[model samples]
Target: MEPCPECGASMDPRSCDELFHALLALDHSRQAPWGPLHGVSVSCFLLQHPSRLPADDGAMAWALLHTYLEGGLDEVNQLVGQARRDNSHRVKGGPLRVVRDAPLPHRDASRSRFSVTIQDVAVDGTFPSSAFTERVKAWAAATVDAWSCGT
Candidate 1:
């Protein structure tokens, strides 16, 4: 398989999508320790794949990621309900929307240019709730760090 142009992970082998879907699956266990961090995981994934996002959604992803960067989980937790209510479609526990309001043809950025991706973290396999939660935060933090470098 070829490396993903955005995150540099191998494609078709379920690299990024695997991690994202696993995090998305956490909706059934929102009461679990890793539940609340789903937004972070979602934002990180969307931000890494800029081409899939429209211009407006790209801005939303950046703002959402920035919120996690500045306020941590407590702040991100505050935005979760609003994101869900913004659209009828479910994103599991992800931030904002997984399905964009606009098409990707007029996107703001074609490339993500991220320094960090799911590849940068130990996201494979299973983990205890607390450890899984930590990895989500770590992935988000790494995404923010990439933004900080203006990538």
Candidate 2:
């Protein structure tokens, strides 16, 4: 479905969910080993910040459930590292933490902050702090993409 041309707001959750599911299903059909993304759940929210206001900040986020046959946590750790490095160059506040987490992502009551907790589904163990920060970065990017279609 097309987004709102004026404000770019597509306030339909079903449409967004269907689009994401369809994309994942089609992609999985061609790639047999694409198990990193087992399932995903997405929801949208309006971003409101008093200090830094976004131009058109309707945000969409996804809860990605992933599974890896071999070295799952290891791979997530690597991705997290990359995310942290990338985010550092963008934000001036310092750095964000990304790690293997358990609790689902959530927005703070104040609506000023949010977080995504990626639990290590692997049997190995919890991931390191430095590595976890990277995951946060990746998740943020993905969330932004899923929300606005880069508009």
Candidate 3:
């Protein structure tokens, strides 16, 4: 199987479909303990699969990733809520205005993107809550690390 060109992660089903399903299961299942991790999971997935979004949405994804890397879900969620509440920036049904508000990084075209892949997130296995939490954190850290060099 071919790996993702952006992140270099190979999946059983191509083009990140399996990864989409995995994130859906984690975020949508009320009975699942992974709900709180939804933000971080989405951030990691979007950052890796930058093709999933347009440029502005991509900026929002990067913003979320930085927030998650800084303070986990709590920090990111707080920012999201604040974004929703700020009516001036709010769209009737569009992306949060925080995209415009956030301090976007300067990307160097000379530098290649993303050294970290979503491969470390482990979509197949059933992990206990604590283990999964640590795994997600590691994934976020690694992704952030890979992008730390002014990417």
In order, how many clashes per candidate? Answer: 0, 8, 0
> Considering only N, C-alpha and C atoms within 3 Å, which residue pairs clash in candidate 1?
none
Model 2: per-residue Cα lDDT at residue 135: 50
**TM-score per candidate:** 0.64, 0.26, 0.72
Q: Write the per-residue lDDT of candidate 2 for residues 1-151, one digit (tens) a residue.
A: 5643222335243332344344355336644222233222112222212122122121111222221112343565464455567567676765443333323323332232222312221112222333433453443443434333323
lDDT of 1 by residue, 60-98 (tens): 566666677677776666655565576546435534453
Tens-place lDDT digits, model 3, residues 49-143: 65675556556666777787776677887877776675444446664566434454444322244544455565454434656777777777765
Candidate number with the higher lDDT (2 or 3):
3
Which stretches in model 2 have alpha-carbon errors above 4 Å?
1-14, 27-35, 38-74, 77-151
Runs in model 1 deviating more than 4 A are 11-13, 81-115, 120-122, 127-130
Q: Scored by CA lDDT, what does every candidate get? A: 0.60, 0.32, 0.62
> For this target, which candidate reaches the highest TM-score against the unseen true structure?
3
Candidate with more favorable, higher lDDT: 1 or 2: 1
Q: Alpha carbon lDDT of residue 59, candidate 1?
A: 59
